[model samples]
Target: MTNYDSAFRWMKVKNGRLHFASIELDIQKNDFENKIVDDYLVNGFKNDSEGIKPWKKGLIRGLEFTLSKSSNFWTIVIKELQAPVLDSNPAIIGYTAILAFIEKTKIIIDEDDLRKIELFVYESWKGSNADKVPNFNKLIFE
Candidate 1:
């Protein structure tokens, strides 16, 4: 697993307003990856009054994904050829967002192990919520 601690650098929420301390992308080398991360940084943060600013979308090698916040949960929808390929269960707005995205995409290939992945997601985000944004000290990704 690789740790992406810089993923949430300079990101936070204060006084019910989402804040992005910086938008520089010196860490990621790939342009596509940088674009994806940039889009998330620019549109992902939520302001209390306006809520989430609609669906934030991205496309990776023809695979399309969208990120949106509803209530306190973040929703990720992955699509192929404009058809829904994976509609993830709602995840709390923290590491759960990344977890859901990774797991749900994995499910597209490992459909037989659905229960296990679902369980993992449920266990990861069970007691989490949006009140506290986790420090991006260590985000493990395989």
Candidate 2:
């Protein structure tokens, strides 16, 4: 068993209105509701399926969300980012765009933030199914 097998506490966006990943992800759903609504992003919602006219929007938003999530990886290659985006674009996808917009500025979070994120993830990693055989909750991530 690993420490992640049991996440005692978590710090999350509160209540940002995700399409619904796992119920456990919404620890402070009400608190971050505004942020969530504003971001209005999701993940894994690919198009070419769903057959719904509105599905494309969701798919695009999900792709953005996925890109944003991947942006955190840039923190490891901090030096590669230029300068303009260093101040803005906290989210991963936004940072990528910011770099594209700016001529010379790339973005990278410092080691401290990376460590914090790492610790947060470590502390957040509860087992998939530990409490009950079919515990059907806690899969939501905000």
Candidate 3:
């Protein structure tokens, strides 16, 4: 059992350009409705029995950018997260070519680690520099 063990679900499309919008699975509708009230984004996996420390948010692990079609994504131009180390491999490049897998799985997820991954994946979609992403799009609800 690790407090740093978390998973995320996200979606993306190549409209004018490739865009990514990822959310933690534990996130509820209230998470979206209340987002405006307070800017707090929560990552639900970092609070329990991870064996070590279990509470130090910094000691946890999480996701990183997996892929992008943009040339800047790999060729050392965008050395954001794992880009510096993971880009040299053709396998990783292949994983990124199809964006669907990246949408759901974070390469790494730690307990309460969703927020950091959210900032990297979700908040980027919210930026003025990026395209607009609706809180709820094609994802179905019951």
Most accurate candidate by lDDT: 1
Report the C-alpha lDDT of model 2 over 54-82, residue by residue, as the tens digit: 22232223223323533322211111111
- TM-score for all models, in order of appearance: 0.23, 0.21, 0.19
lDDT of each: 0.26, 0.25, 0.23
Across 1-142, the per-residue lDDT of candidate 3 in tens digits comes to 2122332222343223343222222212222112111122223233233321211111111111222211122211111111111111111121222232234323332334334333333333233412222121111110
After the best TM-score superposition of candidate 2, give how far the Cα of residue 14 lies from its true spot, in angstroms.
Answer: 25
- Indicate the TM-score of model 1: 0.23
Report per-prediction Cα RMSD to one decimal: 15.8, 17.8, 17.3
Among these predictions, the greatest TM-score belongs to 1
Cα TM-score of candidate 2: 0.21
Off by over 4 Å in 1: 1-35, 40-108, 125-142
Q: Candidate 2: misplaced stretches above 4 Å? A: 1-105, 127-142
Predicted structure 1: lDDT: 0.26
- Candidate 3 Cα misplacement greater than 4 A, ranges: 1-9, 12-108, 131-142
